[model samples]
Target: MPGLRIGALELSTPIFIAPMVGITDRPFRAFAREMGVGLTCTEMTAAAALVRAPEGVAARLLDLGPEEVPVAAQLVGNDPQVMADAAQICVELGADLVDVNLGCPVPKVVRLGSGAALAREISRTAAVLEAMVRAVDVPVTAKMRTGWDYQSINAPELSRALEDVGVAAVTVHGRTRCQKYTGWADWDEIARVKEAVRQIPVLGSGDVRDTALIEARIRAGAVDGVVVARGMLGDWNFLEQTVSQLRWGEPGPTPDFADRLRLAKRHWDAMVVHHGEQHGVRLSRKFVVWAIKGCDGAARLRARVADLFTQADLDELYQDILHAGEGPTGWHRPNFTSGEG
Candidate 1:
């Protein structure tokens, strides 16, 4: 795959890690960068919240570690001026690119006329993105769902409008707002959006789990790139494997049980350092669960995860997880979906 350029920002590859709320924090992004993801985005931040409290919000949601550069800071809101101001804040805080989130399907966001709801209001969404483009010298991009519902699949029209307003690029999640990740993501609709836009790069999202699915979306949708979201949940090596397969036509080195254990430990340590032990240990439970998802006796390990409150708790369970992994080792896709991004 060729590199992707958004405005003056050049990415090494077209593959990007989707900006998932609560899941794509600084530690997670750092690990993704090490794993060879082309671009990493900050988890979605509310424009109004970021503008009202830049320091607090940025610290909580937009904090980028040293390893995380060439990163896109994603903002979500319905207000044009607030979004513009937030874009400026993101740029000030070392964001290489600023992205508007128009694909979030959560009811609160839609109720505020943001996220997927804004995609239905093309002119309004265009106005918001246009202001952001004018506000930041860095690339201004948008990620949106196909439309409000199947009855109104208007990503093509919306993409055209965004491009006309000087938006750098657009990513289309193939599912509609109504779908909310229930069924399959329609790559055909993503291809239609690609056909509609003349200038900016068009990327596709949803249902991109493994190498085969990634290749399928690129070929079938004929998009400029693909965003790996839920697919990267437990499998951080997904991007590395993808780069190897796409660039070299060979699968990259797969992690054995020991390799996984080492990386998982590193990930937990980083999380604790970044988030502090109390919160980090609490937050790391889900990641531990994801890492051990398909291993033997995964249920028992997961049950132990719930009681994890400190490093000692995790240390005690680590041996058990490694012992369980002695039986078999292989990649296991995460069977889940996220409503964010």
Candidate 2:
């Protein structure tokens, strides 16, 4: 696969992380960068918040360390002017790129006629994209689903419209909003969307969990890149593993048991540093499970880890779990439901 050049930025490898809600927060992104990922994007922000008041949650979206370059800020809204103004604020805050999200399947966003709902109104979606591009001097890109439903899988047409208006890159998630993560992803459909555009990078995103799936998608030949989402949740070594495979066509060294524990502690410390003692400890509960997941003795830690209220408690629980015995041969993960906020 060839590298993509979006303006002054040149990504040597095209494997990128998909922007997930709580899963792609600041601490998680910092860990991902340590594992050698190329680019990282913040969670979606409300354009209205950025425009009306640039403090609190909006300011949090612009939080970046000096080393975190090429961080793209994603915006979700139906108003072109609001989105345009938000993009300018992000640029001033030092965002390397701006992305418009038309791919989220969550009902809250869709009910508001934003996110995937934009797919239903193609002209309005295009107008928003055109307006945003003109307002920001930085490169603007898009992340879109196949369409609103099976009856209208117009991603190929929409993809072309985005490219024609000077979108720097395009990422197409193969499932329609109606599909809602069910059934197999339409890889061939993504191929068609890539064919519809020229001079812009096209990326395939959906159901990619490992090297085998990534290799098949790359061989599909339409996409210029791949975005791994759920795959990274429990797999901290994702970037290192995928990059090694892409570069040397071989596997990277797996972390030993102790190394996984150390990584988990590092993540816990960062969460505490950012969110403070009480709140950070609660938020990091699930992350502890994900960090130690798949390791030899990880399962023992799941049930009791969430009870901890401080870093010391977390450390003690890790020791207890490590002492519990052989972990499950395989791990069980929960399914995402609409009930979640």
**Cα lDDT tens digits for candidate 1, 166-285:** 998999999998889889999889989999999789999988767866765665657888888888777767777886666666657887777877687788878988888899999888
Off by over 4 Å in 1: 54-60, 216-221, 326-331
How many residue pairs clash in all the candidates, one count each?
0, 0
RMSD of each: 1.8, 2.4
Task: Note the residue pairs that clash in candidate 1.
Answer: none
Task: Give the 10-residue window scoring lowest on summed lDDT in candidate 2.
Answer: 332-341
- Best model number under TM-score: 1
The candidate that wins on lDDT is 1
**lDDT tens digits by residue: candidate 2, 1-341:** 55567756787677888877776777777887777666788777778878887456666765655667767788888899999999998887768888888977788888999888886787888899889999998888889988888889999888888777778888898888888777767888888888888778888887776775676566667677788777666556666788667766765787655665666677888888888988889988877776555545565566677678988888787676555533555433334332111
lDDT of each: 0.84, 0.76
